[model samples]
Target: MMPCYSGYTKSGDKFFICGKLGPHCADARCMDVGTILCDYPVGDGKTCDMPICESHAFEAAPNVHYCPGHALMWRKFVDAGGVERDLKNVVPFAAKERT
Candidate 1:
């Protein structure tokens, strides 16, 4: 599993994404195995945190994340040979693609 998650939200079944300070997701459906994806409506605002929650909310700047501790643990999991089920390299593949 990824140390963190990335996606939007759903109100009826997709409300919105709430970063580390995450919102209530016990209601959303499981879009991904071992993970949850949701969506929500964006509100009108004018501040630094505004873009963080765009109207489209399509900003894929890492939808969600694990706490620092979990992030570290996840790193160890991969380094110690944890299975990577994602198509993209858990370690990143852009480098190889660029070559």
Candidate 2:
């Protein structure tokens, strides 16, 4: 007996997205379809882009959401009682918010 695949690309390399093949939520325990991306800025005007379901996403600002990992970090910063001006240094693109 042999296994079958529809395409030449390896399964791991395939890019699954929302819809039929549905991208999975990044959370290991969750099986929900990922419909949104984490908005955490990475660099060069790019974002984290981690696929996440709504339930697992943290809304940082209007329509901006972060994955669980970044979200936790954000929460910790807030809980630490950092001043508002310090946010510009903590977040990758927060300096733009000040402009």
Candidate 3:
């Protein structure tokens, strides 16, 4: 299963939004402030929404990032010579139209 994060501040006031100092990294081991969200598409037109720090994020493409686990999966897919169209089918937003 994919890792995810969702919670509020200690005061139970501020909600966690990855990238800000308020939220922590989704990776349990790291304590660094999250810098971005995993771009991996989940379902129902929603993304993984996994909070990831700079060190834990892997750029699959420009402005497209994946969490450590997803990154490894992506790497394996690429290594196996996966098709780009297949990836687009999974994450349409990550691909842009060409002129």
TM-score of each: 0.23, 0.63, 0.61
* lDDT scores of the candidates, listed in order: 0.36, 0.74, 0.75
**Sequence-dependent TM-score of model 3:** 0.61
Regions of candidate 3 where Cα sits further than 4 Å from its true position: 1-20, 84-99
Per-structure clash totals for the candidates: 14, 0, 0
lDDT assessment of candidate 2: 0.74
Model 1 TM-score on a 0 to 1 scale:
0.23
Deviation in angstroms for 68 in model 3?
Answer: 0.7
Candidate 2 lowest-lDDT run of ten: 1-10
Clashing pairs in 3: none
Output the lDDT of residue 80, model 3. 81
Point out where model 1 deviates above 4 Å.
Answer: 1-62, 85-99
lDDT of 2 by residue, 1-99 (tens): 322212113343433223354577788776666668999989999999999877788999999999999999888888887646586678464445565
User: Once superposed on the true structure, which residue ranges of model 2 sit more than 4 Å away at CA?
Assistant: 1-21, 87-99
Residue clash pairs of candidate 2:
none
